[model samples]
Target: MFQRRKVIGVMGSGTQAHRERVIPLARWIAEHGYDLLTGAGNGVMRTAAEAFVAVAGRTGISIGIVPGQATARGYRPRPGYPNPAIELPVFTHLPLSGKQGQELASRNHLNVLSAQALVILPGGEGTRAEAALAARYRRPAILFGAAREFRSFPEAFERLATLEEVCDWLLGVMR
Candidate 1:
């Protein structure tokens, strides 16, 4: 069968509140059979994966993009580098630093472009960078949670305060 599930990229902070919000959103996406793509780190990434796994009869996949994977030693493996919820992990091994290097940029670029749409959760520069890339690539992005605080979104971005609104927008638009 030649079937490609539209991937939904999730960007966000690792805060407790952020994770709390992502839980429901991730479950909805999984229940609806939409694949997911995330940075594959801890905090929000783990929360999303956990939420996806919590659902039954979920056919969607969880893909994690691990940056700075140049080599096993390129970057230290954190406790939850590849969260258990991830069914597949793309180790980019980008030459740039995993945190903030050219490699991270490459990862963010790929994450933003690969997905049909993105649901951005409030985070730091990495999350913000993903939003900027979405603008540069003209990708549809729905900003959720504290990310809405980041006013001045680019032309392609829309700020959604709730998970339901973000999910609805993604399903309605990304089909």
Candidate 2:
């Protein structure tokens, strides 16, 4: 599917994202007119969604790729789970995943494939895994706020110290 709007995937820690950097980056993504795609679980995703919704005159969509069935296993869309700002919530019908990771692998695939680029922030194993997925998918991605240790498939990812550099690169590439 060819999206008319540029979709940028922001990958980072779901539990412990850097508030100062992530929040501003979220707002910037909205302000710059780029659609955002995320796992939409919590933490970084929620922070970005909230910031995007706060900005006025944003010409972007906040889409969440949720994992789980719509009804099976008592799955239901909640207001606060994916944050209240997501305009398009996609239910993957996989499973709520992190460690026991089959569903996570699927969710990760969708997350990487849906976007034109990925912005990686500070994170743990899961974040690392997402980076790897981006590499495998040959998706343009960058790692911010940390060292570039993950083995990129093509080994061409950029490592930036500040969020501004990351944002600049993403905007340039996507635009």
Best candidate per lDDT, number? 2
Question: Which residue pairs overlap in candidate 1's backbone?
Answer: 13-122, 69-93, 70-93, 96-103
Q: Over 4 Å off in model 1, which ranges?
A: 15-17, 71-79, 95-105, 146-148, 152-156
For model 1, what is the error of residue 44's alpha carbon versus the real structure, in angstroms, after optimal superposition?
A: 1.4
Per-candidate clashes, comma-separated: 4, 1
Task: Tell me, by TM-score, which candidate is best.
Answer: 1
lDDT of 2 by residue, 1-175 (tens): 8858788888777897577777888888888888888878677887777787788999998999876656656776544556577789887666544553324535777887898989887666666667777777688998776564444322467788787798789868887
Model 1, residue 99: C-alpha shift (Å)? 7.6
What's the C-alpha lDDT at position 12 in model 2? 76
TM-score of 2: 0.83
| C-alpha TM-score for every candidate | 0.84, 0.83
Clashing pairs for predicted structure model 2, backbone only = 68-93
